[model samples]
Target: MKKNKDIEVRIEETKKTISGSTYDVTELYIGKKKIGEVLAYGPKEFQSFMDNEELGASKSLDLAIESIIRQWNLHE
Candidate 1:
């Protein structure tokens, strides 16, 4: 996918503990700012982590509106 100048995407892997349990972690960053994170058990963990509310919470109402604007501009 083509990268957008206004928004940057970054992904990193780390370790985290939840409820006294340790697991692998995957984090998403937008322009050097962390937006959300995900946790899982194995190779498919990254996919599983994305279903978390934290990822959804990253899409605020304002952000959604801004994204729509950007999309409209690109199409035009």
Candidate 2:
């Protein structure tokens, strides 16, 4: 399995708000490919979405990355 360091993340600052809040949605990427998106409210608060599915919220970005990799069956 690939670790967080192995994945390249690119955050796109969107002007759209989430849940009626001002939180921005950031897109996750590995190299030139987008893997998922995250609605990050804080450092320990975020909601991850991938493959047109909501992967839910979590406290750690590492956890979110791991889940994305696992759910997508990505290999190093």
Candidate 3:
């Protein structure tokens, strides 16, 4: 699970409210930039997205990071 050192990963727990119901959302960030979000409860736990583009989903964060690296073509 090697990643570029310059690329930072952060997961934040957030609360979203809709129709008087509140739910938790996990947001993915690279450095200070936001990449995408995933629901805490879902079939695809590590789904990634950016600017409305789906970066595919994986069962682990390592796989998700790999997808992001390929998508952005970041140097490892």
Winning model by lDDT: 2
What is the lDDT for 39 in model 2?
71
Can you write out model 3's per-residue Cα lDDT over 12-32, one digit (the tens) per residue? 888777578766666777778
What are the clashing pairs of model 3?
none
Quick one: ranking by lDDT, best first?
2, 3, 1
Model 3 TM-score is 0.49
lDDT of 1 by residue, 1-76 (tens): 9876665556677888878998866666656755556555554323222224332222333343344334335544
Q: Which RMSD does model 3 reach against the true structure?
A: 5.2
Q: How many backbone clashes does candidate 1 have?
A: 0
If the candidates were sorted by their TM-score against the true structure, best first, what order would they fall in? 2, 3, 1
Q: How badly does each model clash, as a count of residue pairs? A: 0, 0, 0
- Select the stronger candidate by TM-score from 2 and 3: 2
What is the Cα-based TM-score of model 2? Answer: 0.59
Q: What shift in Å separates residue 17 of candidate 1 from its native position after superposition?
A: 0.7
Better of 1 and 3 by lDDT: 3
